[model samples]
Target: MFGRSKPLELNVLVLRDADVIATALRTALAAAAPEERPGLERAAALVEQAAAVPDAALRARWVHERLTAAGHEGPVDSVRAVKTLRESVPGLGLLSAVQLTKDAAAHRP
Candidate 1:
């Protein structure tokens, strides 16, 4: 008897390392549309900037600033905030995104 095929499931990629993030960005760039290219390029540049920084705290602070500027801060739902952060900064890992969300929530007005 023939076996049934399993349904396709979406997988989440947690990008933490700078090299891995840069590779993902490059792959995205290859397939992105004209309008989307600019944003992806910007994310790639951010990854480079973060990689160049030797201090971990400074990099985290820079990432937080970027996340806040993109309106991924405040009392927003944690799940949504993490998702938005990943979307905005493709190089951000799940743990970092969650921490950043909590940090934003703590400083909410």
Candidate 2:
């Protein structure tokens, strides 16, 4: 007898979830020093923008721009930053953890 396959589930960020991540980013940003706050603020703004866009590609573009603006460097540095954020703030989900580096890579020059 053939076994039934399990339904596939996409672990992506819904528009509403972007706000949750932004709130977490804001909380993290608030605890950062004034010198480090600007970068965090830029990222939070991008996340807020992503929340309003329904398209994944557009949201990814926002994440890419935020990563580059925040001086995330190449893919390795970008991935490291996302990992650090996820570890430091458990509320950040997997989609957010990979969004910067993965999408940025596609949009990188």
Candidate 3:
């Protein structure tokens, strides 16, 4: 019989189309000068295929993981924008985040 295990409690955030992000990261890594792309390709695939987690904390964690794979693990102050929006308008920040992404995509060069 297998031993019992403690359930991991995670605040899962539903990130829509995270695989796309992962895919982009992979492409960027492949094109980059360096060749030690450890988790970049997998990260890209995750971003491109992972389902929306339905939790802010989880979403943030996913972002953090991907960002880490992309060689970023410092100064997440800018990434922690949800607290500001939540403080001002509760859960409205989620919509704000989505809208911002939409706007950015629409205006992408």
Please give each candidate's TM-score: 0.37, 0.36, 0.26
List of clashing residue pairs for candidate 2: none
Candidate 1 Cα outliers beyond 4 Å, as residue runs: 1-16, 55-109
Which should have the higher TM-score, number 1 or number 3? 1
**lDDT by residue (tens digit), candidate 3, 36-85:** 46566656556544454434445445444443455544443344433432
Write one digit per residue (lDDT tens) for candidate 2, span 21-103.
Answer: 98899899979999989999999989878677646566466555555555665563355767654565457575655654465
Worst 10 residues of 3 by lDDT: 100-109
lDDT of each: 0.69, 0.64, 0.48
Query: What lDDT does model 1 reach?
Result: 0.69
Total backbone clashes of candidate 2, pairs 3 or more residues apart or in separate chains: 0
Model 2 residue runs over 4 Å out of place are: 1-16, 55-109
TM-score for candidate 3, residues paired by index: 0.26
The predictions' CA RMSDs to the true structure, in order, are 14.1, 11.9, 16.0
Ranking by TM-score: 1, 2, 3
lDDT digits (tens) for residues 22-94 of candidate 1: 9999999999999999999999999999778554444445546666778865444368767887788777677
Model 2 worst lDDT window (10 residues): 6-15
Deviation from native of the Cα of residue 100 in model 2, angstroms: 26
